[model samples]
Target chain A: MTAKTHSLERMIFFSDAVIAIMLTLLAVELPVPEVPDPLHLWGALAAHGSEYIAFLISFCVIAATWTAHHMLFVHVSRTDPQLITLNLLALLGYVLIPWASKTLGKVPNGAGVIVYATAMTFLGATMLLVLRHVVRSGLLDPTAPRGVISGIQAWSAMTTIMFALSIPAGFVLGRWTM
Target chain B: MTAKTHSLERMIFFSDAVIAIMLTLLAVELPVPEVPDPLHLWGALAAHGSEYIAFLISFCVIAATWTAHHMLFVHVSRTDPQLITLNLLALLGYVLIPWASKTLGKVPNGAGVIVYATAMTFLGATMLLVLRHVVRSGLLDPTAPRGVISGIQAWSAMTTIMFALSIPAGFVLGRWTM
Candidate 1:
């Protein structure tokens, strides 16, 4: 019942709720097929392959981000309002993923892909920023290894670079399939 | 960290991710509004009033359930495998919300509303079960007040009763608007 544990618990509880809802939301892109001919059902679904692809990609992104978030929190010992706010901002990046994917799913346009990639990049960057904050602000357990933070740094960097590159690559390809 | 803290943390983290994803997924029912006449966009958006209503109801249900979950967890002082499994099963209730909402959104039938209401009832009841188990098994903090537990019991009972009643009422009314 210490003040700090209560604050941390609130953040953890809220973060878990947000992540759970966002992860499951990916299936919203899928529709129940209603083809008259059972044989045509596969083809009918295949026709909306972009939507499926968007869902898959977004699902992986959210799952990976959740993984990273959980890993980071294990080392997080204390959370201030600022840290909670940063976490909230990072969750906002996750909230926008569905919007970005829906746009991509609907249009499959260069603009849509750019927006999607940009959103992904933002999530990666925000995670990186949080990790940096946790490490720099002494919010982590003293026993927490430097290696854990370094590993996340590397992973976050890769996510940022790959996603950021997809912007121009999406435009050059003329179709935002990326 | 105590083994209990780790177990609780894992459950909280996973549950949060699931809730977060499901809550945001509600918006998927809304279309991007592709009216050729820009003037008709508002009308187009307003046309799907039922879908919006379904979204709002489900959103509140999930948010309220999350609040309840958070409140109850504040008194939870220990954890075991059974508790974690029970928690996961309750989370399954959340996982199914999107599917029920999607059905209700697509068909808007007595069947769909019944399905949605049934899911909500399951969540409420499972939460009640968890609360009762925690109280019975002496899993709560020693300092926790008896009044807090009784208050949650009252709220949980109300949720369970209202959602459960919607089933027969859905058939009587030929629609489950609430």
Candidate 2:
């Protein structure tokens, strides 16, 4: 492998590590329902339904983000310092996801919803920046299909816009905005 | 990429995710020392010295494990089902490292020490098994260096032995065994 390929691989590995840690962090603090008796187990678990839902939602979001990252990197043949910086910035937002999920689970209020939405929006926006950097810098493989490249960029842009819009919806819809 | 390379890539990505998650989980439950005033902060932090040490040790161990895995996989060009299974088993042991670290930090007893040591030994042994599988099953690239392969196996075996020996020392030395 060329030095460029090796550097790119390291970047991808580091990003994957951060993404994985954030994904699993969603469950690290999930409360295990305590019950007085065996019969109360189901009832106690049912009471923490919101926490479970929060976990599920964050898990899906992180997984989808990882999928997008994996697909984009498949077309990428090299990396630049700017792209690496943007990737790190994107990871900074990802690392906040679990904290946002926890706040939403505990409060389920307008503020909590806003926090979660903002984190998601930041993550998507940073990722979009990375995609744009990759495209503008000609870092992708020479043979990469035009349709695939545009498709990824379009999807990233749309996701970022949706999350950005959700911030305001959090004020009007409360927890329902999630 | 051929189907085989794609499958191997997926396996490597999944392993990287699990390793990253486990590494970050080491810090997830770390206690932030509470103090009544700013002046008492250093003293309060110093009180949890063992916890800090445990965290540092586990972090290094996990990071070293990841480095070894990366080095080994650089020679491996494909994966088999048994190799995948062994990798998962290795991850199961790795996922226990954070819990073991927590126990050692909290209790600092023989049992806790033994738990931590055993987990480390299991991880090393399983990774050694992966190396052996790769070599025996011809999963490595044809151009892979023989010296590099044996060096990894030798290091893994030595580390596993050291951890196994520590289990007995934990009985006699208590927390100092760490």
Candidate 3:
């Protein structure tokens, strides 16, 4: 095999491994509760219910992000060094998902929502940037339309707005629920 | 592109989309409580907290599985119809993750733990079956050693064991926390 092929192979393997590990890292933060009295379980349940809610929302959000990432990679059969770097940068934002989950879980405050939304916005933007790079670099399948990049751009913009809106919604709901 | 190439491309796209959506599905069950009172808010938090913990665990588990999947695809540049079907079966289990998360969130019972573990076990086993098919089909790089498959098998076994242990641990912890 050519040296370039070997390098590309290493890039894909390492990138996949890192993304996989980062995706799984969110699970490490779970605090296992100690049940002292089965009877008082109701009390414990009441105190912690919001956390569970937050967990589920975050889980779905993360899953959605993963799906989008996978879709973006579909057109890419080979990776250039720049593409590899772009993917890594995109994943760096992904790795912060647990932190975003924690923030959203604790307060569901405006700050928390904004923070979460901002993280997602950055992630979405990074993806768009990568898509642009790919299209410009001619790394994408030639048969795929030039408009596909615009579709990604449009989706990124819409998702960003939605994420931003969800922040205030979280806080308003958090306050209302109380 | 050759028909074989087109099929492989479609399979990769399908895999990416499915996995991404599955990851997103992890958080769908989280509560979005309407504020009624202090007690209600806290109650929501507590419930969601447990679900969050489960989501976290599943998140990591999914990432690990994705890593394994990516690794498997590394040595093989092409895939056959049967391999695609086996892969879809593996993904079918992954798609079930959202449901599993929801179940664990609602009950936190021993049975729930068992159910989650069963799903995980099936996922791991199907992965192994797919890998075996690939190896048997002679789709892998000839330069690759027999031990590569063995390596994946070892990893999957350890992962399965971890999930099995965590199920009971999660149940006990959930009970205690509640």
Candidate 4:
């Protein structure tokens, strides 16, 4: 294999592993609430249910994100150092979900809401940044029959929408929790 | 482009889009409970909380599923007709989730739980079946570092475990909901 191919292979392996682990880490943030009695257990489950809703939202969103990432990489026959590093930066934001979840779970407070929103914003923004880098690098086949640019733009817009909604939603949820 | 590459590209695009759409659909299943009294909104939210918990668990599991699929596909350099068909079958189970959620939401009883569990079991099993076909196709570089057999074996075992847990848990949840 050429040096470029070798490097790309290593990066793909690393990226794949990191994304998988980070996705798994989401579940660890959800601590099973304490309640002995079945009745009380039901009540506790009901009480903290927003945490679950938020978790589901984040989980599904992350799945969509990963799906999009997978689609992008499928066309990527090779990657340069810059593309790999940028992709890692995007994955870093993904890996930070546990911390973000912790803060979001404590929501109804302004700081926590802002922190969570900012984290999501960074995650979405960095993903777009990485995609732009990959596209600009010409790593995509020039003869790729279809326009990947539009797909990238569409995905970026969707990410932006999610981030935008989360800001106000976070604030509202934070107030409610508090 | 070679016919194999074109066909692979189409399969990847369709599968990825379906996965993304299905993951998004999971969140849309959460309905804002009807409440005539604005003052009773909190109570309504509290009442429907278990639905949220169910959504979260399903969401996380699906995200984990997507991650697993992503990792497995990394070793596959090309796709065959049978493998693509198998993947579509696996994804069919994924797309069925919103309907399962709807059923589980309405009945919240033994039958609904069983149905949900069965759906999950089929989903996991189908994924494993697809993985096996991909590995056996020799499209993957045989000398590739990742051991195809072991990886599939581990994933297969995990799928079985998940299926096993889903059935029992479904029974318990079904009884509870009933």
Q: Model 1: runs farther than 4 Å from truth?
A: A1-4, A7-13, A16-97, A100-178, B175-178
Question: Per-residue error at B27 for model 4, in Å?
Answer: 31
Q: Is candidate 1 or candidate 3 better by TM-score?
A: 1
Tens digit per residue, CA lDDT, model 1, B1-178:
7888778767766777777767766665555534323234346446766676677678667766766676677677778777887888898898898888877776755877788889989988888888888898888888887886798899889989998999887787674353
Position B7, candidate 4: lDDT: 51
Better of 2 and 4 by DockQ: 2
Residue-level lDDT of model 3, residues A46-115, one tens digit each, is 5766666656776776676666555655655566657766765665566555666665656544545655
Fnat of all models, as shown:
0.26, 0.14, 0.00, 0.00
Considering TM-score, which of the candidate structures 3 and 4 is the better prediction for this target?
4
- lDDT tens digits, residue span B1-178, model 3: 6787568657765776677656654653455443333334446456567776777777777766765665566566567889989989988888888788777666755666767887887888788788878888987767656675678878987877777676677668667766
CAPRI tier of model 3: incorrect
For candidate 3, the lDDT comes to 0.66
What is the DockQ ranking, best to worst? 1, 2, 4, 3
In model 3, the runs with Cα more than 4 Å from the true position are A1-178, B33-47, B145-149, B164-178
| TM-score per candidate, chains pooled | 0.58, 0.58, 0.53, 0.54
Provide the lowest-lDDT 10-residue window in model 1 chain A.
Answer: A169-178
**What fraction of native interface contacts is shared by candidate 3?**
0.00
lDDT of each: 0.75, 0.78, 0.66, 0.66
Candidate 2: where are CA atoms >4 Å away?
A: A1-7, A23-178, B175-178
